[model samples]
Target: MECLLGLLKVKVVRGVNLAICDPLTHSSDPYVVLRLGQQKVKSSIKYHTINPEWNEELTLSITNMMHPVKIELFDHDTFTKDDSMGDAEFCILDFVEIAKRDLSDVPDGTVMKTIHPEKANCFATESHITWKDGKISQDIVLKLRNTETGELVLHLHWVNIPGVAR
Candidate 1:
C-alpha cells in the first residue's frame, strides 16, 4: 500500500480561445486529462467550442511532492483517436510548502507567492498562491506549448492527509 501523503484537488475551471482542431466544423470537442505519475483523471468532453468551460474537479493522489502534474487537452473524436490540442505541466511544491505552514495569522486572500511566466514554465500570465477560505491554493493561466492560440485556467487546492506528516 502506498503511504498516505496528500490529495491534490485540481479544479479545471475553463479553456480560453483553444485551437480549432476540427477543420470541417471549425471547432473542436475538447477534454482535459491530468496526470500525476501513474494516475490519470479526465474531464467530460465539451463539444463545438473554442472556449469551453469545464468546471471539473479532478483529484490526484500525492506520494512524491516533487512529481510534476501534467495537463493535456485533446479533441475528442468519435471514429478516430483523440487529437492533441496541447500540453502543459506544473509543480505543486510551493503550494504544498505553504500548506505545511502555520498560517493562523495569515489573512484571507493573502498572496503567499507570485509566479511569472518564464521560458521554463507554462504560465500564460502571472500566477498567485493565495491563502483563501483557510486553505492554500493557486490560480494559473497556462499557455499551451506546441500549439497556437490556447490557454488553460485551473485552480490547485492542497488537501492534507491525517495521521501522516510530510
Candidate 2:
C-alpha cells in the first residue's frame, strides 16, 4: 500500500561536479531519479556531461512525510545496465512544517529555517529555508553519499491542498 498526503513541487535545479562514470570518455551521461514513498520520477538524461543542469520542476504527491525523498544518480549507458553513480536523501518534514506558517508578511529572502549537514541528512552544507519571491522555498545541496564526488541542488515547495493540514 502507498500513501498520498499532498503535493510537493521539487525543482531539480542542477548537479555539481558529478563523478566520471564513463571511464573511456572521462564523463557521465547523467540523470536523476527521485523517489518519495511509492511515487517515483526521473529527469531527462543529460548526455556526456558530469555537470548536468536539469532545471526541471517535478511535482510529487506527498505520500508519507516520515519517509525521506531518495535521490539516485545514474550514468545512462547503451551497452549495459545504467551505472549507479551515487545516492542521497532528504527529509521534508521540517521544510513543510515551517512553510505552513504565516509567511505572507515575511520579508523576501528571509531565512526561516537553517538545516545543517549532519548524519540524519545528506546535506553538503547548511541549507536555508527562505521566503523568497513571495513563496516558501528551501535550497538544498545534497552531497552524494558513498561515492567519489557529486552534489545535487534542489528547490522544494509545499503546496497545501484544500482541507489538508496546513
Candidate 3:
C-alpha cells in the first residue's frame, strides 16, 4: 500500500491574527511547525508580530489517507522554553477521494468517486478542492483553537501516479 500513492505537497501560506502569548510584553515572535506522521517541517520565525506570514512549502510522501496533518504555532524564546500559542489540524481524505476519481479514467480498473462538501459543516467552510495542471489540489483555512484567536492558510497538491492501484 505504501507504493500505491504518490507525493502530496503542502504549502503553508501564512498566518493571520495570531494570539500573543506574552501579554505582559509588547509582541511575540511567532513561528509555525507542521507534522505529518514522522515528517516535520518548521517555518521561519517572524519577529515581534501578531500576524506572521510564512510562505513555505513542504512535501510529504503520502501512503495513508487517514493521517491528519498537524499545524502548531509557537513563540520563539532566546533563553527560556518556547511558549505554545495554538494549533489546528486537517485531513487529506477529500484530496484522496478526488485523486481516486481523477485517476479512474485510466484503462484497467475502476476507482471510486466522492462528492465535495457543499453544505455548512465543521470541515466544510475552510476546505475546497480543484483540478489544476493535471493534479487535484485543495486549499484549507483552519481556525486555531485552545487559545484566543488565530488562523492558518494551507494549499495542498496531490499528484496522481499512473499504474497505481486505487
Candidate 4:
C-alpha cells in the first residue's frame, strides 16, 4: 500500500488561548502532538505560556482516508508526566470532496465550502479553502471540546499521488 500512498502535509500553525493546565504556576508549557495511525510527530515545547506559536510542518503518507488524524495538546513537565490539555481529530475524508476540485479550474479568491466532522471530540468550526503555493490548501481553526476557550490553527495541503484514485 505504500506505493499507493498520498502525501498529506499538515502545518500546525499556532495555538491561541489554550487552557492553562498548570494550577500551581497558572501557566502551561504547551506542545502539540499529531498522530496518524502508528505515526506520531510532536512540536517544540513552549515554556510557561498559554499561547504558543509552533509553525511546524509534518508530512504523512496516507493509505486510507478512513483513518482520522488525532491532534492533542499537552503540557510538558519535568517531573511526573505530560498533562493532557485538550484534543481534536480530523479525517482526510472531510476534505475529499473539496480537494477533488482542481485548483487550476477555480478562479482566484474562490473559497470552497467548509467541512465539519460528523463525530469528533475536538473539531474545526470551519475550514477556508484557497489556492495557494500552486495548489489547493486549507486553513482550519479547531476548538476544544466542552469549552470555547481553546483554539488551534492548522494548515493542510493534499498532494496528489500519480496513479492513485481520488
Candidate 5:
C-alpha cells in the first residue's frame, strides 16, 4: 500500500522513523522517498520485530539543500503474505548532520571503505557505487530476516552528489 507523508513544513532529520502508525495494522517494511526541490532520494527497510531492546536503526543523510523537502514512506510487502501493518511501531532514534562533500572534494589520498563479510554476503545482498560527471551515486540495499521472529527487514539507501567543490 502507498502511504503519503506530509511533514507539513516540519524539519526532517536522518534516523527519523517516518512510519505512519495510525493506518497500518502490522508493522510494514518501510521505504522512504525524499525530495529536495526536483531531486528525489529514496531508502527502504523491511519490517523486523523488536525485542525487549529495540535495535533497529535506519540511518539516512541529506545535505546542502536550500529548498523545501518532502519525505514519503511506502509499506514494503515484497517478502511476506500477511500485509496487515499490525504489531508495528516505528520511531526516529537519532539524527546527525554531515557536511556536504562532493566527489571532486575527495582528495587523491582519500579512501572509500565498506564492510561486506563473506558470511553476511552469503546471507544478505551487496551494493554498488557509481561515479559520473564529478557526481557520486550509490545504491545500498539489504533484505534480512530476523532469526527470532522470521520477519524480514529490507534496507535500502541511495544518494546522489550533484555539486562537489572543484
Candidate 6:
C-alpha cells in the first residue's frame, strides 16, 4: 500500500522565526510534516476537534542548506494509504548567525526571566531563543539588511522550548 502526503514550502531566516498553520476540519487528528532538505519532521499534535488549528512556530537554526525546506500538513487518518487531504506550502526563511547564548553556558550577570500568560486554562510563554548581534540600545533602533532582498527581517521573539528537559 502506498501513501500520499501533502506538500508545503518552508522558508527560514537565519535568526528570524516563522509560524505555520495546519487546518484540517474533517478528521479527528490533524498533523503536519516538515521537510528540511533531506530531513523530515513530523508533528506531535493529534486528537483535534473539527476544523482543528495548529499555529506552530519554528526557528531557523541550521544554515547549511541551499534549497527551500518544505512543510506539508495533513489529516492523520488521510495521511496514509492514499487518504491524504492536501498539503500547504511555505518558503523556508533564511537565517544568519549572529550569536549564541546557551543558558547553562552563559558567562555571568545575564538575567533571564520567564513570563507566561494564562489563556484557555493553559500557560503560554516564549520558550525559543536565537541570539543575534543586533540589539536596541539607548533607545535606538537596530536592524539587519537581508542580503537577498535588502529587507530587514528581525528575528522578533523566541517562544518555544528547544528540547525535552532531562
lDDT of all predictions: 0.90, 0.87, 0.73, 0.77, 0.32, 0.31
Runs in model 4 deviating more than 4 A are 97-103, 116-121, 146-148, 161-166
Residues 81-141, candidate 4: write the lDDT tens digits. Answer: 8988888877677565566655676777676765664464355565667666566688888
lDDT of 3 by residue, 127-154 (tens): 5576655667777777786778877777
TM-score of each: 0.95, 0.91, 0.79, 0.82, 0.27, 0.35
Question: Which of 1 and 2 is the better model by TM-score?
Answer: 1
Candidate 6 — what's its lDDT?
0.31
Error (Å) of candidate 6 at residue 19 is 20
lDDT of 2 by residue, 1-166 (tens): 5545568899999999999988899899999999986779999999989999999999888766777899999999999999998999999887777766778888888998899999878999999988888777888999998789999999988777777655
Model 1: per-residue lDDT, tens digit, 34-115? 9988999999999999899989899998887788899999999999999999999998878777888879899889999999
Any idea how many clashes model 5 has?
Answer: 8
Higher-ranked by lDDT: 4 or 6: 4
Candidate 3: lDDT over CA atoms?
0.73
Prediction RMSDs, each to the true structure: 1.3, 1.9, 5.0, 2.8, 13.3, 14.9
**Model 1: residues with Cα > 4 Å off, grouped in runs:** none
Name the lDDT of candidate 4.
0.77
Top-down TM-score ranking: 1, 2, 4, 3, 6, 5
- Model 1's alpha-carbon lDDT is 0.90
Query: The CA-based lDDT of model 5 is what?
Result: 0.32
What is the model-wide C-alpha lDDT for candidate 2?
Answer: 0.87
Q: TM-score winner among the candidates?
A: 1
As a whole number from 0 to 100, the lDDT of residue 110 in candidate 5 is 31
* Per-residue error (Å), model 6, residue 77: 2.6
Of models 3 and 6, which has the larger lDDT? Answer: 3
Ranking by lDDT: 1, 2, 4, 3, 5, 6
